[model samples]
Each structure stands twice: as structure tokens, then as C-alpha cells.
Target: MKKFRKIGVAAVGVLTLTALVSGCGTANTTNSTPSSSAPVPTGNAGTTGKLEIFSWWTGVASSKALKALIHVFNEKYPHVQVINEAVAGGAGSNAHAVLASRMTNNNPPGTFQVHAGNGSLYSWVQAGDLDSLNNLYQSQGWLNKYPKSLLNLITFNGNIYAVPVDMQRANVLWYNPSIFKKYNLTPPTTFSQFFQDAKVLKAHGITPLALANHGNWETTLLFSDVLLGTVGYTDYNKLLHGQMSWNSPGVVQAANTFTKMMQYTNSDASALHWQQADQLVANGQAAMNVMGDWAQGYFKTTLNLTPGKDFGWAPTPGTQGVFSVVSDVFALPSKLSASQKAVALNFLKVLGSAEGQKVFNPLKGTFSPRLDANPSDYDAYSQAAMKSYQKDQLTLCIGQGAVNPGFTTAFENAMAIFVTNHNTKQFIQSIENAAQTNPLS
Candidate 1:
């Protein structure tokens, strides 16, 4: 998917058109938000068959969410068995690769979890390796609930591709509440103030930003947040679209800001995955971690801490308000039995249905994509995300969301080298060199 705000108009236009072709052409904008206004649950048809589901989810809460959805799917199809095939490691490389291999071997799962957007999963769907969910989507009236902005990401060539399971609000700052109390520091609302607070925390021997750059993508998070905060969304998009060169002053500034964060982070951040870094904050070894809502699930399932009392959530303090997102979506794989296809489509509908979103998204510690879904009882940090989303002011991560997988890596690689070496000049050149030129009409 092209991250909405990342690439400039050219890339954005290309992606938007690509989506219109793949996810479905123009999405209708007259839909109402899926709030409490939804109709009372009425009986939907049930199935009595079996289908296998596969995803890269390995966390307890992740599994719980998937299982809950499966349970609901079973309520309709009591005899239908939803088999789960999940494995860990390599940031979904292993699971995705296995699924790709399976596709060739003729044993692909009925449905598979994937990242949202036309840039990532569109190829497989376009290859006729996945089933079109357009018929099912329209039959169930999902368009009226999910909205064109959200649903359009899954729509392609006038056909919908997948059901989004969860939306991760990226670039959030989760701070330890107690640590703030100890230092008498309130979470600052601006980047400048935030940095000042970080200096204070550093004086007292605290790592202000929970950073682990091992997977390398973690560094991309910091760069994305900085670019969004400093350069403004327009230039950030241009940078990703290759309209603006990496040698621009904005990239230079964002890189410097990232270097400042490194100074305040744990020295071991180089070896940490985002999870391990979050653990540092949960365990009080660190004061903050800038990540997405998924970390909220990690804290709940792994550390078992209360959100508001233990930690406070804040967005990457940049302009008045801006948002960043990453969503977990599932596409129907090709080569499904008729019943399996039915099950897959039915499962997707359930995923977006009011109940499916409520049970699954909350458990996953993510916000529901359905517009009207309330994040009732969500911990403090997550509600902060809702505030951002509702404002429609969030910016998407440029490199990851705007660039394709191949190009996304090029950006990540440039960021990793920059973060480690703290080299502004070299980093700017690297990004300029790595960005793939894409022109739009």
C-alpha cells in the first residue's frame, strides 16, 4: 500500500490509481462512521466447514485476538474448523517466505495475514493468486462502515482484496508514568520540550527513548517520526516520492534529530528489537519507547501492566496533530476449495463486522478500522491514538508505507547506517542514491 502521506503526489497518484485498479476503483465517500450507531446484531448465516488461517502473529495477545475471531467465525459455522499456522522470527520474513513457497507447492493457506496497501500485497492478488472479495464486501455493506479512506487501501482495480484486522497507530511515545513522577516531568507536547525533558532524564541516568535498532526497521521509525514532525507532511511525502532529493535540508535535520535520540537511548539499542526495547520501559529500565499501538498489546500480555497508571501515551510531538499507521490485513490466497473460498470471504466479513473488530482489535491492542467503532475501555495510551486518528491529521510512514518492499529496504538500510554512524552528510547522499525515481501524471 502507498502510505497516504509518505510519497509526494507522483508516487501517491501512482499508488492511488494502482489501488483503484486492485482494491476497487473509487470508493464511495458517503458512508457513515461505524460508531455505536450500527444496527443491532441480527443473525447472519452460519457455516459448517473447515478453513486454515495463517499469520505471523506470535504474541499472546495477537494469538488471542485471532482465536477470538475464529471462535466468532465458528458461532456461524459450528462445524467449521479454523486452523492457525503461525511461526516467529525475521519480522515476518519466515512466514511470508513459507507462504510464498507454499503457493508454488500448491498448499497455500486459505487466508494469510499481510501488511496493508497496494504496494505490498497487490502483486499477489493481481497475479490471480488471491480471490476477489468485492462480491462479499458489497453483500455485507462493509463500504458503509469502513469508509473509503480506510477501505480504499484494500481495494484494487474495482475489487476489494482483504479485510483489515487491526490498525497500528505508529510513532506514539509511551512513557513510564512513575518515571515522570520521580523526575517531576510531564510529557511534553512539543518536540523541543520533549528533548529538554530527555536531557533531564539523561542527567538522572535514564534512557529517554526505548530504542532497539536490530531489525533496522526500528531506526526507520525514528526517522519517520522526525521527518513528520520537522519537515512537514508535504515535503516528507515528496522525499518518499523521489520528488525531493534525500539531500534536502529536511532529511538532514531529521537525521540530526534521530542522532540526538540515540544519545539518550540505551547503548544496547543496537541489538534490540522493538519488543525488547518496550520491555525496557515496562521493566523500568528505560523511560520511553516510540512505537505503535502493538506495543500496548505487548505490555498487556507480556508485562501485565496498567496503561494509564504505569505509562502515558503521546504522539510524536511535531505539528498541531499528525498520525501514522500500519495495519494487519489478510488476503485470500488462490487455490482454495469452494467451501474454503466461502469460509475465507466469510471470515473477512466477520473481521470487519462490529463484533469482529471489537473483540479482535481490543485484544490485539489496536484500534478498529471501522470508523464508528469506539475504543471504549482502551488504556490511556491507545485513546491518545484515537484522538489523533479522529482528527485526520496523522502522516503515514514514508519509506515503509510509501515505498515498495524492495525500495523500503533501501531506505531502511540507509537509515541503519546513518543511525549507527551519526553521519549527516553521508546519510543524505545515501538516501538520495537509494530512493527510486517514480513519476506521476
Candidate 2:
């Protein structure tokens, strides 16, 4: 959510924005070049070297999960040393900046964490900085192992560019069951019910929604959830694809709902990090929080809380049939030495393998990207998420990776403005301008 200068082409004119607002797809397409063939090295080709993997998983649960996965990788090839260059803050904002700088300077890591959609992955692809994984998928027979929707997110022009480690459900509404039971309330399934519950919770001196906006993406994330609830799946996807406008009536309503919902949130929300916000709900200081399932790892591993008893979860209001997804994936950089490439490919293999996913996601509070992953290996919460993922209408999450990075940054700035001013019209206008300046297509 740090204000970032727009980095992509700014060819989308105001007229294009207006047309998109009217639900016309007339904008120019910025298609990526199809990936060329690259030789797929078998059995690592006797590779023995250091593999530097970069990511923002420095938290206790995430770091431990990465280490566990690395341990598994080492067991397969003990000669390779894995350097986990994790930079953590602002839910990957700091890491992203560092990675961008590294990429700009031509000092890329062997593999780096990127969101699975058009945001980070497509930016790298458009810049011609990524190595296609199509050969890798073919060599490993992974074409049928993963869900087609997931593969489509990381693939472009018939080329796969990244290996997704795990899938996170971004539209979860987590609540303290004890507080809900005390109030004789059940999890709300609609925004009307949500507002009614918020009023009751506020009357009893409980913050209705726990929010941490110190990282501006959290604000954007909340708005994205509301937008999905307001516009539903089809239009939300259109919005992300630059076929719909930010200034549309649905977006205005979503922004208005976001502003109204903020009224019941903790006053100190802007000063807290996401973990602190989750703590507010965990300690029963707040009744509920809308976040990805990673909060389950914090509550379970860090806070030592039981899942079903200490906290409960439901889909965000009006989003029961939708799955807003955020996946952490590792993409190979175009620049790599032969040995580094071999080790990197091996590392990706580990990431995409069933054993790695089974060991990693259970501890990380997410589910495997693969459809064939063993459900019994995950916890009750993750099992439910995996089931929902299979059955729900999938949509890309903005903060996670659904749109272009330039557009994502612009939308974050709009959210920052909306959070301070609470002007719904201005908020809509700001995002419309953002879309005009930073077109996704």
C-alpha cells in the first residue's frame, strides 16, 4: 500500500475508462509474448549449488513452514544449500519493493515469491524477466495435477510461469464464537445481517470488525471483499480484467459499504498491523475480522488457540458461493547460471510436489494448489477451505494478485484516500483515474 509510481504502459485513455464503466471491453489488449521452448533438465543434471529463494514469509508459522519444506528439499538433494532470503513487513510490500529493485538491477534470485495472477507474475512476464515453466510442467506431467483455474492464473499465452506453493482463501470472516454465543448471534450470510450484527456488537461496547490499516493493502482487501459482495463474481472478474470501471455504480456502493463498515471498526485500526488486528478478535476485544485463512496459523501456532472452540469462520457476507483466492508462487527468473537453473528447477519441483504441499500448507494454514493433494493431511479448517475452493466460483483477489501491479498500487492509494476522507464519490473517481493511468490490459 505504499504509494508506488505507475510502472506499466499508460495507454488507457479516459474514453476507454468511460467505455469500460459502461461495461464495454474496448481497451487495447497488452498481450504478453508466448514463451519459447527451453530445455528441461532431468534429475537436476548433477547440480550442486546454492539456491537463493526470496519471499516475505518471515513470521513464525510461515518461516517454520518454509523451513520444513526446505528440510524436505534437502533430504532429496543434500548437496544444495537453500538460502531463504526472506524480507518481511506490510504483508510483502517491503519484499516486493526489494524484489523489484533486484529485478531492475539484473540481480535476480534463483526463484522469488510472486502472486499467482496478473499483478506480480504478469508484470515480470511483460518485462521479459521470467523463465517459462511450460517445459517443466510437461516434464513433470503437472498439466493435469492442478486445478485448471489455478493453472490459468499463472499461465499466459499457453505458457506457465510460476509454481504455486499454496492457495489462501481471501474472503473468510472469522469471529470469536464465545462472543457470538453470548449475543445469541450466528454468522451473518448477507450484508444486511452483517450490519445488524455490527450494530448489536457496537451497542455492547465491542468493536464489530477488527481492522489493521497500517498496511494500506488491508484496506484495499476489505474493499475488494465488499466489491465482490456488491458486484458478485462475473463483474468482479470484469473489473479486474479492465472490462469494467472503478467508477461504476457497483463500485460506488461497495465503497460506501466499506466506509460505513469502518464506523464499527477499532479506532486504533490504522495503527495496528494485520496480526494485531487478528489478536483483537482472538482476545474477544473485537467480534470479527475479515482476512485470509493465514490468521488460522497465527491463532493456532502463535496464540495456541483451538480452531473450532476458540474461533469460528464463515465466508464474508454475500460471498458464500465465491472463492476469492491469493496464492504464493515461486517463479524462475530469466537470468540464472546453468547450475543455478537446475537447482531452481529442483526447488520448484519440491514446491509443486504433493509431499511438499502436504507438509507446508498444514502448518501454514492454507491448502495445496494441486487438486490431488490429500485432504486428510490438512486440518479441519483447511479441509473445509479446499472443499469450498473446489465448489465455489473462483475470483482473483486484488491485494493477492488479481490485477496488474500498477493498477493494484493505484487502487491502494485510492483506498488510503477513502479511509481518511470517507468520500465515496471521490474514492470512486480516484480509482477511475487510477485505471485510466494504469490500465491492466
TM-score of each: 0.85, 0.92
- Cα lDDT tens digits, model 1, 30-53, are 222211111212244325566778
Off by over 4 Å in 1: 1-49, 399-402, 437-441
RMSD each, Å? 6.9, 7.9
Highest TM-score scorer: 2
Error of 2 at 121 (Å): 0.4
**Ten-residue segment with the worst summed lDDT in candidate 1?**
32-41
lDDT of 2 by residue, 7-45 (tens): 111332222212222322122235767556455767646
Off by over 4 Å in 2: 1-30, 43-46
